[model samples]
Target: MINLKISEPNPRESVREYAYRILSENILDLVLVPGAAISEKEISDVLSISRTPVREAFIRLSQEGLLEILPQRGTYVSKIDTEQIAEFKFLRITLEQAVMKLACSDFPQKLQEQLCNCLEKQSICVKKRNHEQFFIFDNMMHDIIFTGCEKSYIWKIIQEANLNYARARVLDLSSRQDEIEVLFAQHKEIVKAIITKDTSLGENIIVRHINKVISDVDDLQKQYPEFFK
Candidate 1:
């Protein structure tokens, strides 16, 4: 097992959620790759916790289809399911598109300020070549949109549905440099649409934004055949 060190568990974060966040990020980043054996004891030991929380994390990952827990064979990272990718991408895009439509009409000034700040931070991350931070800010921007529409529950479901999307995003960031460069500009455009209450423009941009991954899957499959199913 690779050496793992997590930050001191946050007081507000339940053990299981902390463990889940650490393991989930590693899995998504391809550090703990598909088909690799994962030991609950090892992880719990790293986190300086009992096996219970690690096991809880394992159960959650299994439910999200990010890990396969076999009774006799031991737990291993699950191969990326392209089908799940398609389904969840469709679901997320649909939800976000709806959110944009709702949020665009009378888009609150405070939320607009938050989104613009997010976009600015995203621009900085992209310029600094900090792909990880860029991804984090990207999600924050979207979550703000969802929250603006009073659909926080929808954002939770999107997060749960995003295992494959997360992995694919890593690939997307690594490979699509030119388009990634444009993403900040695109984010600005999205915010502009919202500020002006232009739902049609927002929808159009979001569709292209969300579909970029699906459009590039062939290249992803060619690059990492083993990661895909």
Candidate 2:
């Protein structure tokens, strides 16, 4: 098993919240990694927080599907459940496409500018070959697009679902230069489609983008079946 290292806590963070964010990010980034065993005391000591907060965080993460609490075996970073990932992908694509369609009809100038900035950052990340930052910007781009649709509740659900699938998508980032380039091109097209109020074009591009991620998951599962549940 990999030895997970937790960071020192910030003075401003509540112990339970800090533990939650740290553990959640680690899981999404695959740093704690899937199927890894976890000890509350070990995490508490490493983060310099008490076991109580760590336990609270564990329970929260378990509720979020990021942790598995086995009775005698103890808590573990949850395995990658392909079925869940598929469900997440389906929901994200379906809801996000609907949002894009709505945004196409009622394109707002402010939202477009925000999405433009995100796309700019995405370009910079690509130029620098910074995968982590690229992913962050990619998320911002989607956030701007989806949140602009005024469907806040659905947008929030998409965020949680995307987090569940993000690690697998990130793993597929290595040496995916051509695919990455196509993504930026598609982003531009999507933006243009929205700007021109072309709902069909926007829907098509977003659907293709999401399907590509699903395809990548298939590639990953084939390459490393052990990493998945």
Candidate 3:
């Protein structure tokens, strides 16, 4: 189990925001596993805050479908819903393809440089066996593509909608740590396609790259059944 550190609440940020950020990070880090019971009082006590703020945080996470606040039982990390995962995958792919199509046509030099830097950073992450850093760099590369297309809004929606898929990707990353090289290769191809302004090439590469992020859902579901519904 990962140890969670409670951060000091910033005066500029409300207690609920602070609690929410901390709790969200912890949950994503799996310090609070799915279906694990959590109480507003315990959280408030631990964070040295009042119950109201903790309660508010719980409400927000629940709204995000990341938590389940039972009426009388208690609040718990929500189990991953595979149906939602599939739905998000479809929605994400559609919007991303549109974004990539624009990016393929525009193919700005600035974004290409950014992507090259991300690819280099991702390569270093692979060498260091740093899954977390690899994931961060991966997102940055994709975000740069979105920026190139002037569609960061779509990227934000994709991020907000794919929490379960994100965690599942993390699990897949752990099992296939060596697969980072292949992922980096795919990223390189996408970048090259974009740099050369090859629309069809970019389309093929980007779809394959994005789909690879969730291709092993069945295996992952089998491995981490408790984390899923």
List model 1 lDDT by residue over 1-229, tens digit each: 4665357667899888899999987898777877788899888887788999899999988987899999988999998788888897779788888888998886678988999899889888877888878888988998998888888888988887788888887777877777567677778888889999998999999888888877788788888887787
TM-score: model 2 vs. ground truth = 0.90
lDDT of 1 at 221: 88
Residue 164 deviation, candidate 1, in Å?
1.4
Model 3: worst 10 consecutive residues (lDDT sum): 1-10
Report, for all candidates in order, the number of backbone clashes: 0, 0, 0
Question: What are the per-residue Cα lDDT tens digits for candidate 3 across 19-121?
Answer: 9999987777666877788888788777878999888899999999889988878889998777887887788778877877888788778778999999999
**Pairs of residues at least 3 apart in sequence or in different chains that clash in candidate 2:** none
Ranking by lDDT: 1, 3, 2
**Candidate 1, run of 10 with poorest lDDT:** 1-10
Highest TM-score, which number?
3
State the lDDT of candidate 2 residue by residue for 162-229, as single tens digits: 65578777766653766667777888988998889999999999999887777787778788776788
Q: What is the lDDT of candidate 3?
A: 0.83
C-alpha TM-scores of all predictions: 0.90, 0.90, 0.91
Q: Is candidate 1 or candidate 2 better by lDDT?
A: 1
